[model samples]
Target chain A: MMTALLVMIGLALLLGIVLGYSALKFKVEGDPLVDKIDAILPQTQCGQCGFPGCKPYATAIAHGEADINQCPPGGEPGMRALADLLGVEPKPLNAECGTPKPKSVAVIVENLCIGCTLCIQACPVDAILGAAKQMHTVIASECTGCELCLPPCPVDCISMVPIPEKVDNWKWRYPVIEIKSLAV
Target chain B: MSLFKFHGGVHPPEHKLKSTAAPIRSVTMPLRLVLPLRQHVGNVAKLMVAVGDHVLKGQLLAAPDGMISAAVHAPTSGTIAAIEERLIPHASGLPDLCITLNADGEDRWGDHQPLDYQAQEKSAVLDALRLAGVVGLGGATFPSHVKLRADDAHPVLTLIINGAECEPYITCDDLLMRERALEIVRGIEIMQYLLGAKHAIIGIEDNKPEAAAAMRLACSQNSISITVATVPTLYPGGGAKQLIKVLTGLEVPSGKLPTTIGVQCFNVATAYTVHRFIDHGEPVISRVVTVTGRVAQPGNYEVPLGMEIFDLVQAAGGTADDSNGLVMGGPMMGFNLPSGHVPVVKGTNCIIASAPALFAPQPPAMPCIRCARCAEVCPVNLQPQELYWFARADNFEKARSYDLFDCIECGCCSYVCPSRIPLVQYYRYAKSEILASDKARQAANVARERNELRLARIAREKEERAAKHAERAVGARAEAGGDAKQAAIAAAMARAEAQKAEIVPQNVTDLSPLVATEIKAIDARRGKVDDRD
Candidate 1:
């Protein structure tokens, strides 16, 4: 009985070592999904989707905890691309999170003057650069259009004007209905 | 094998008892009614009567243009106040054409007849459905007439009646089954005959035992071979695929339908409407709706089509202070209405007025940790995380490879996501975006085709003019016919001018063929595409 027990113990240890070695040998390598998801993101560096940046959001999408609809900047197209990537059926944008509004940036009224720096602090992407108690102006370039600056403006001067459809901003509209063959 | 439990189905507290306990009641129609033009799926009905023209209830207000379309009927006898654009019952608060009527207060019916629906030919029954403008009221809003008219070879063996009111806070179907089970059964028989199905199975969720019992009893005396089977309580059991699966243990193959598996599915209300449509020749103008949630007397009410939702809200003891989000249909798959002012269309199932307390605020989305919960809950086995990652990367080419279209947008993924990610919303956005891009491509293609045709026409005209000039020159060469040739040349010039004038309007009409011909041409084009190897 002692000999049999000893043999069994030895076999178990050997199997464990083999399994450990095999696991080390056969690592599945890096994931391609995270890289793909990260690529689709606008790279605004805004944490509007609750992820710290685009990379974290992409990772969450790969892991399945987050939905592709969380990012407002990506809009409908981004959501659809993510849905397609995730192999899920696409649905309408959840109005609760918000609708797909045109890309807009906050324009602070230069004359509203009392720059308490509240708008700067509220800016998710650090789009606005202003000092405390100084006459502040909006640096339109970095504005992610999350409207975070609008709420903090006690004077209600910051407004989101739509970005014009320029050649650079223009995207082709996708097809609405799938063309099916006519069967008589 | 944990009973195929899917990810992302929310366990919303059933507030069904508010109206479930009460019987179905007929609501009072106000002094006015407004019927929308594009209520059902397919092309909007063409208005038959002009403004100020009087119409009776159940009267054909609009006529169908084609086989795929449905006719619109007047809900009540009234003077046409206006045929104008109004906010349509849609998730995206958009406006659509509507027929406004100042009710003369006389709810009158037009000419109609009853028939042994089985004796009537399938074509005639389909005509009845089309004439009545019958559409699936179970959120799909598909033309009922079109659904029954499947291809010659695709034989329907079983008619599956969907009674799975699995969505929380919606008991309209339940109340309908309990109150008018006989009518529904009769409608089911009509559907069975319409589709030439051998047997009929009514699949009701186990939650509505009372409804199931009532349906069973109603079909007891009927000659139709109707069987009522109780399905396990699941959120989307009401979906066409899920209901058919539960009833027959059959899987509708990917990219196929229940009809392909010899099964035809219809909502319970649609079945009831079918009976009225076939038997009495009454067009579907209105439907029974459940007005409940955050209001005082919440229950099922028979409301007219295009009736203002605010009217019902008022009749149901008005909206309470807590009614923040007013959603149309059930909690899970329903759409949020911009305001309650939007008129009810054929697809409007239920109007819910719930506060944030009921539907809690969403927290920030956290990173996914490679959990396979989404895969486990997916009714269709799909790698959701992988797809999500690809979609986020804007790699649609790779996403298509994953079969994105097969995702049903059932909200199962969104419901179960611990990170509170609106997964379904993302999918919708992606689909719309893809669709929009595809549309742009198609429009471009169409423009290119039109340009090519215009160029060809110009070349042909140029050739014809040159030929006419050559003919005139030849005639002038024949001796003293120079004067006649000159006259002929002048006439030819005049004729050419006339042809040029004709090309503008005549060819413009020729550009877009008659609506029917255009539909036919579109179908023909589709056939060519399908015939492609």
Candidate 2:
């Protein structure tokens, strides 16, 4: 009986040492769940999710402080991806934030801009190019259609222009599969 | 010779005799030629000519933009009318940048000279071919120089010439082999010399006996020994991978090139152009196009590049009265031309005037019965039904895992599908959707990285500003020489005294008499309240 007890204690000690070493050696640096949630976000930096940007929203989601469906730019598909990652049921997008729309880019009317530099300060991606008292222009490729610059423009020169589908960016649509009844 | 068979293939009715009835003829140049910059399978060629520039026949109108791209040349002497977006001969039916050339009718050749390939370095020969704008004339217009490049690391062992011409209603390569076998054989010798290949084999479908016989005779006459093997006539047998399997008994690993196995395949017409560029000093100015199905004259014509299909139909004695529309390739794989005005590109081997009688519209697709007929006929040995299910459900990951990209879209599955489902269309949709989503994911990753970098930069700037302010404060304290607090108090007191001196009651002097009386009464009441407090 004593030998058996000693064997059990010895085994427990060895396993405990191994487990302790592994915990120390393989310790993660940061919250990996936050990084994963960030990856699923569209990174529009639009702040429709009641956070400053996509990363902060991702952090909130990771911490259970925010819902997965708060991002309008990400839309339903992104919500579903996040739900899949977090092993939760997907819910409908929160309509209070905004409705999903086609991707667009900000176009600054150079004549009406007035060189106020308000839109430049509002753009989170730094896609707008100008200095104070200078004509500003938005780099269409880099503009995430965040629409943050819209409210700050005193002259209302910034407009959201939907990107047109051309041969280069055109995508193939889903195939139409008819569900015929077998009774026929 | 012992030939190996691939996993799955179908035998479609051979409709080639209709076009092979007559020898290849040259068509008259159209009034205007619309040449798209993206005829090959790579980056669009860089335009070299401006509007109103006069170009001679075979003059370089656009140069290859990068590796794996082909140069574009003038088919006939012409003046550039416009460089604008025009409808191109593509399944997408989208308009892209095209150079509209108004034919000058001079057909003058530019200054050119044939390359003495034997005397020059192999790289020089390949470079000359690239400048000459030679490409595979078989449906896929991949640049020929890119394929001919053989390095010591992957030395080409065997060269396979594709004379299979297996697609129904297309016989451009068949006629080329029958007539210009000598030139093609000579071109094969040049490719062999460049690749340093041990031997070359020309695989022609047994259906075209005359083409096979001519190739055999030409091979005998040539100094280099080239074997002429007759592969079984099958739909999509001319596909590079399929033909390689028949001739070499080797399967190109999925997602890998045939060059990985030391084998390279070139279309027969590509060889003819290589011969013309190396010997006769000619670029790819024209290609043999088969105009068949519902036409008065169904024959192969050596049509100049950029000639509109509408004009080519006229050259072929016009279309039949019952002709419904024009298809740019074989009925199995071709798509209907958006309009007859689409021009002939380097890949335009045939133009079939499809009619209700020729190609009946498919009946509405029925639900799959799980029959394996599609699996039996798939040339790439893929499960079409499963891919169809996954695609219909928008499960692109599942479709990708099922090897959806391995499908060649030969239409054999759709041809044999009992339910009349457009299986190939589903595969095409799934493949394109996967590619688009992959692209979107990459873009999102890039945006995330850029956003992180910008945030880092902003934080760094803020820290630097804080550091600078701290440094200035430290410097000010050092200048005060151990009396910094006292100096700050003195400076604050002096600022207060300056504020006292600057203060003045300007409104008190400017008030009207009645307003001044009311102000004085209010001030007397306030003084009484203050005295009470």
Candidate 3:
């Protein structure tokens, strides 16, 4: 009986040492929880979530200091995705932040553009191309439709326009009806 | 040879006799032709002719833009009227870039030479096919040259010719086979030579006994060891995968091509086109389109590409008074066209003029009774009801997990659904949504990468500026005096700190005042705790 008890204690001690060694051997460098939360948040960097960027908001959420519903640009779907990842109940998007809107990309009216660089600086994706005192244009394909550049245009030349659907971009519309020949 | 059978399929009514009963006739040339740049899938062909330029018949109008695109040729000698947005054949009824040409009626030919495939290198033959605007004529309109190109990994074994023509009211292939069997056999020989395939099989439906007999006779006359295997007549048995399954007993895995399994499939009409282009010095400027349903004279016509469907329908004795709608393909798989004015594209196989009595109006869709009849007829063996539920709810992830993309949009599920639910439409909606979202996600990733690079560039620029300032200050301090070295260092350190404070990335927004205050408070509380410890 004494020998069996001693063997059990010895096995427990060895397992504990191995577990401690493994903990140090393969340690992850950064906070993976923050990374996962950041992945769930839309990287709009619009500051509509009251944080500096998506990363900061994600970090705040990881630290238990921020609610998961603070993101407005992410909308309810984004909130639910985050809630699923964080194992929490999804809450309604915080009204203190901006309301969700349809995606719109910034379009600069070249004739009205005052050649100011403020809008260019405000763009998070660096999608605007122009020099000072020259006409600026937004690369539509690259623009995230974030609407962040609108506030920085001193001349109000920048406008958020909904992306137009082309023939190729169109999805099949529903409720197809079948018509047969009556005179046959 | 024995034939293999596929899992699930439906046998739709074959009304092919309405058109195939007569011989194929050439349509009268329309006044103008409107050719869309994006006729054969892939990227839109780049325009090679400008407005007002006169082009001859078979003149290259648009060059292939990329590897997967097909070239566009003028259907007849004409003056380029306009290169503007015009309505083309599509489900959406939207306008896109098209070339409008007014035919001069002379039918003048362009400078061209027929290629001797046997004498030329394999690569040369493939290149000629690409230059001649050859593509699969089996509705998908994929570039044919890409399929014929030899792959080192999957050595070709069997080449399957799709003569099944399973869709009801579509008999263009059947007529082409009965008329041009020898030409198709020659094309098959050329494909076999190009692919180095050991065997070739022509798969036709049992309903087309004449076509099968003619093809078999042609195969024997040419001494080409091609087998004409007749598959069971079923809706979508004509599909590349289903035909492959039926002929070779091979199930092309989901998300893979037949070429990956040592096989390649092509439409018999595509084979005929290739033969014409290679042997007769012609480009694909026209194809045989079946015009039936509600017309006085329903028959197959060799219609020129870019001929408006209205002209084709009018050539078929025009639509009857009872006709209310037009469908571009067969009754089962076709979409309703908004107008007959849309130009005939490379993929226009059949046009059906619909009337209230011919295609009886469906009752309002009743709720699915969980009867699972749709699942029974799905050619891809997908749970159509489950897919319908997920698609209607906009839960695309679940739909994707259920293999939504595997659906070939054959309309078998929709055709068999007792509730009259448009199951294929829902699946199409889901598939398109998934594709669009995938594209959006790709764009987002690109933007993210660009944003990261911008931040890195800003940091680097700030560092360079700080280094330049420090260098100038050091030079100034050294030139001033050795005794003022410590003061100079202190001044430089303060300036560097200030520069660091000012050099913030533009993409990162400033924190809100409330959050900033809260963060500061937390930091202070942590400091106090550390002190107490």
Best by TM-score: 2
Question: How well is each residue in B1-533 modelled by candidate 2, as lDDT tens digits?
Answer: 99989877888888888898899998877889999998998888999999999999899999998888899999999899999999998777789999999998888888878878999989999988887888898988999999999977788899999999888999999999999999999999999999899999999999999999999999999888999999999888999999999989999999988989989999999999999989988999899999999999999999999999999998999999999999998988888998999899999999999889988878898889999899998888888999999998888899999999998889999998889988888888888888887877787787788778888989999999999999999999787776877788899999999998999866788789999999999989999998999
CAPRI band for model 3: medium
Chain A only TM-scores, each candidate in turn: 0.65, 0.92, 0.85
Question: Which residue runs of candidate 1 sit more than 4 Å off their true CA positions?
Answer: A1-184, B1-12, B461-533
Off by over 4 Å in 2: A111-117, A131-134, A177-184, B482-533
Model 3 gets an lDDT of 0.89
**In model 2, how large is the Cα lDDT of residue B300?**
94
Error (Å) of candidate 3 at residue B281 is 2.9
Model 3: per-residue Cα lDDT over B317-427, one tens digit each: 999999998999889878899788999988999999999988997777888899998888888888999999999898999999999989999988888888989788888
Model 3 segments beyond 4 Å from truth? A1-5, A174-184, B481-533
Worst 10 residues of 2 chain B by lDDT: B477-486
Per-residue error for B450 in candidate 3, Å, reads: 1.2
Q: On residues A1-184, what C-alpha lDDT tens digit does candidate 1 reach at each position?
A: 9999999999999999999999999976777888788766665445667776567778888998877788766678778877877789876665555556776777888888587988876654455777988877766765556676777688998889997653222343321333567899
Write the number of the candidate with greater TM-score, choosing between 1 and 2.
2
User: What ranking of all candidate models by DockQ puts the best one first?
Assistant: 3, 2, 1
